[model samples]
Target: MPDSASDVFDIPADVLQRETARIFRGHGLLPNDADWVAEALVEADLRGIHSHGVTRVPIYTERLARGLFNPRPNVCVVRQGPSVVSVDGDNGMGAVVGRRAVAAAVDVVAETGCAAVGVRNSNHFGIAALYAEQLVAHGFIALVCSNAPPTMAPHGGRSALFGTNPLAFGVPAPGERQILADMATSIVARGKIILAQQRGEEIPLGWALDPDGRPTKDAATALNGVVLPFGGAKGSAIALLVDILAAVMTGAGFGTDLPDFYNDLDRPGNLGHFLLAIDPARFGERDRFLERLGRYINMIGDCPPAEGFERVQLPGEVEAGLRRKHLSSGVPLSQDILLGLRQAAGHADVSLEL
Candidate 1:
């Protein structure tokens, strides 16, 4: 088993993916679903988003082993109208259900030029960018968002009433980087707090408040308390919009109805997500759109930065760059996380090879 005194393990991406899949498969997941979960987790790690990566495998598999979610869901889809499609996830893993939803939207948009797919009864799907990036890869503009478990306080309120409520968008740019952005409506995601706690670091003030409505720097206190909204009322308002579309409109649990992912081990999350896609070809030629996007990227890069900043960067640039670097060197995971994952795998007699 891994220990803190050891150097951080640098596992090959492919090896980590297979090990993750093997552990999930041992826990009664289908081969395809196991693979999907593994790949999604590895991708998040590769992109340097440790909060959404393999660090989550222990909690996920624990819930799965305890019968919190369906290992194999009979996901169903219904066409609401010419441009609307409804998906029932049947309590499936978020990544697996999300892939099915995006695939359905792609099929519908091919004929309708645009489509909206609403999803319900899913678990935390890792990262929203993973879903939106699919549309960008297929030459379509996509918007994706999800409602999480309640952790953020509404504007001017002391009690937590909303999830971080993330929003993600991806637009295709032929010659330029993909316009992919995934952000939380709060000052920071709940994941960041979890990460800080794991690393034993204090958080910056204004990021979160204690349970009694006092600003806090302690990560653990913030997790038990409330995460603050980004721009006071504005971010809270956006979180509300996301909750409405991704949960209320999708016929899934909203606000107080959702279960706590960290503590609740035997109950399904009943999470929901929403996806909207538009084919650029419908508005104009694909080549023209790509070229225009490249122009805008160049124009923005040419601007002068303020004294404290270096150069301008787009939304997806940093993560994309990190991915390229990690792919060659392997992903660095802390000994604590590696040991936890090892313990989880060991229970199933799965060899992690970390």
Candidate 2:
């Protein structure tokens, strides 16, 4: 059933986690890996970014069953320099590989006050904010970028030539509220289009082009077509930068050779991610910096609203509020995604409730 905008759906957070864990375990993921993956998916839902939430569980399970993803592959730091490290994911689950990379970056930054880590051969690791927030919790500023399978075309091109190329940045604050910005270079992330298709809704024009290279609003057709960059040349330029940093710099798959995260089971996806962690204390007095940040934030917040707007919000503020509300209530799932999850569970010999 399609959910009405005002209609609320609620499930206990623990129940949602357990359901996800069950789904992952049934797909042959180890207990620890299942837990971490479940947490990441749930975190996305809590933050109201349903595109990266449990809706993707079925896809992940399908990839696992098709032998396209390894549930028990090795993840190791292959090379380490003074302030840089490279990790090989060995076709493992992306949640595991991504977490390991973040952990390594955290460790390096703790010692060197700054560190950059590149990971290759990983899978879809969900929201970039998850990794950035991890570093934020440790009082370090974090920047993360990932290269996806090519679904976006570069400027002046008619065919797909670049990945959506997501980027995320996070900074720790004095209080519980951390500042974060996460977005895809495209006009819309593929996950959002997927969600629209699943919900049988039409997307806005200019969001994507049909396979024949014409503007389209049909979500299903858009999936086969190319997603436009956010601001034309500017977004396309950023996508190129992400490709350089996340794919070329890390020696992972790039451009047309990037593996499709959804299908194509023949080869390893070789998704690449780049992460940086920087300790504020190393640059100046931490207390003073935070104080200044707080003041700046207040100034932004105190700006007068325009038209029907009530207030201004800093990056991540809306998401943080949504997360708090969802945690107490429940993360809403579209009926289509719910059915897909049930089907995946059945295939894995696992049971799902509603």
Return the top candidate by lDDT: 1
**Cα lDDT of model 1 by residue, 1-354, tens digit:** 345534586888888889889988887789999999888899999999888999999998888888887889999999999999999999999988999999999999999999999999998998899999998788889999999999999999978889998899999876646678989999998988998998889999999999899999999999989999999999999999999999999998988888889896757898999999999989888888878888998898898998997988888888998888888889988888787788889878887776
Which pairs, if any, clash in model 2? none
Runs off by more than 4 Å, candidate 2: 1-8
C-alpha-based local distance difference test score of model 1: 0.90
Model 1, TM vs. native: 0.97
* Model 2, C-alpha of 336: deviation from truth (Å): 2.2
lDDT of 2 by residue, 171-278 (tens): 988776568999999999999998788678999999999999999999999999999999999999999998899889998899989777776767778999999999
Minimal lDDT window, size 10, model 2: 1-10
Per-candidate RMSD, Å:
1.4, 2.1
